[model samples]
Target: MAPRTYGGLAFIAEVYLGSPSIRQYLHVDTGSNLTWTQCFPSSHSFVDHIYPKYSPEDSNTYFDAECETTAKNSTPKFTYYASTGVCSYELTYGDGNLIRGRLAEEMITLQTRNGEFKVVYDVYFGCNDQAVGNQYIGTGILGLGTGKFSIVEKLGSKFSICFGLIMESKPTHNLILGDGANIQGHPTVINTTQGNYMIMLEFILVGAELKALDDPVQVHLDTGTTICHLSGFLFNFIV
Candidate 1:
């Protein structure tokens, strides 16, 4: 995990997509599913591309994700229309930016720790053409969220993230996926609610005192977001 903050976002990893493999830098986000990259011939209102756009015509690995009988389970992050018979998607970000595109599968290449590249085929992603936002400087998002098409879910592997000391000038953080993931300490059951990683946070420890909350709060764990949101009632009670 090469975690450097830019545009108030943390962690951008170098990734390659397609058959021949075009290089791209993706923002590592766990808060949302539906991995997407900007494509060429976008709408006029689409976000300006600082990096080159992803062209499906250039990749032999590209395959369109077809229709499901029902629009409901078609895709967790996509909006389905029977007339098209193709998986099209629309995603909204926290900052009110919405992106629209078609869903497709392609080969993805990742750099290993030894600096060797590993190619994983048939990875689902959105080849987005329209978006509304200032557009953070990057290719797109590498979603680690719990949704069906997310990189983690598609790989069907357990992943782990290790954080370094806060005061360290150059923190040595690590993100391990599949067999290399190490999560052997204490274990807590994780529950998924609408692609959110939910865990019951029953108590809070301040100094030597352990204080129990009146009501157990369900916390969502997300590496994508840097801030936490609480209900007004919960905020007042905690304060």
Candidate 2:
């Protein structure tokens, strides 16, 4: 995996999708819940034309939830476009970027240590027809959050990622999923509430001074964000 620079921020991973298998460099966003890409009929959007657009018609394993009755009868539920009556999605990012498209399921290929493997899963991804803003520099985003539509949640309940320092010349990183994510670490048990991984931060230590927080602060661990965000009071205290 290589680091892709976007508006001064860097992201990792280049995922291969569909039967023909188009490679797309995407943001490995742990804070997001859905994985999507620019698809056919998205000429209006300012997408990278260098990469080929994904065509549902090209992949035999591709299934559209709206058009196919069998797909609609499947276990997973899908949202529909009000006017078109097609299964669709509309997403608005934190940076004010927006995307509108239909939902689809297709085969995904992954490169593993053993070898390359293919998995046919019900991938709930948007086939973007419209996109706004320059926040997205790559083909799409790889959602690693805890939502049902997230890749981690859909495949399994396990995933691990190691971030590299920006100053490193050739930074090394790892993105392990499923059984491969069985590596050990300094473990801390946390609760999952409101579709987020939350931890209680009791206090902080600066130099030799120990600062105890009045109340335990709830912090969300997000890989999508580049920097840590602190409350005004916490910032002042830390400063």
Candidate 3:
């Protein structure tokens, strides 16, 4: 759909955690969970995988979680956008890579319905590439969106997480977490169905111009989806 509005909730540039002594960067994604990272492997760690060591000395926010082995395997069980959810989480992003590790009890900063607070939980923090520099968003993801395991889903009440996207030439756009506060006044077109967690949407294009259809089409608005897509037939006509 042709998005309107330039500002709502801004993408979090930085997030803090742990005592004043230790903290780290993390990427907030609404997609998947099973938070993991690379840590010092004991005799149990596989020798085949390339594990980037996490050292407390180098990072100001590094702290010991006293983690124990939950499970281990050659490949991850979870899958998001082609990456497996092996015990050792191996993820290849566009420019950086991540290696999965175990979760430990440590403090993490997250925003809730009440406000922002630090909560101690196990996090995956091991697969950082040294060449990628400080690409970490803040220790791990702040999974929000409508996904099953999102941080927001785990919350007891209704709350929201905002995601912002930058347009090529036009102004930026903000995707709301709850009812979409930015588009509050605008005419919000939504499609709902049974047994589905998401609302479907269809952008109406008439002639050579893009516009909302008199009757919006069916679509799934999934925060977990990496990109917005249209069917081949519809796409060709729209373009």
If both were scored by lDDT, which would come out higher, candidate 2 or candidate 3?
Answer: 2
Candidate 3 Cα lDDT to native: 0.38
Measured by lDDT, the strongest candidate is 1
Compose the digit string of candidate 3's lDDT tens values, residues 1-239.
Answer: 12123122223223344444233323444433433332333323322222233433444455433223433321223323324323233444433544444333334454334555545343333332221323433334444433333334344314433433434343333323333224344454543343123444546656777755455557754443345677876676566
TM-score of 2: 0.82
Q: Rate residue 120 of model 3 by lDDT.
A: 37
Candidate 1 deviant stretches above 4 angstroms: 1-8, 44-52, 69-71, 74-86, 135-137, 165-171, 184-186, 205-211
On a 0 to 100 scale, what is the lDDT of residue 127 in model 2?
69
Worst lDDT 10-window in candidate 3: 1-10
Tens-digit per-residue lDDT, 90-187, candidate 2: 67777788787777776677666576765646676666778887767677777777775677866677987776665466766668777678656788
Off by over 4 Å in 3: 1-10, 20-23, 35-99, 111-140, 145-149, 162-197, 205-227
Q: Model 1, 1-239: lDDT tens per residue?
A: 33344533566667889978887777677776777787666773343444545688888899888645224653344656788767778777776777888888899998776778778888888888777777444667788887567888666556777766534666566666566677767898888887778899888776687778888989988766567787786667666
CA lDDT of every candidate: 0.72, 0.70, 0.38
For model 1 the local lDDT of residue 172 reads 67
TM-score of each: 0.81, 0.82, 0.46
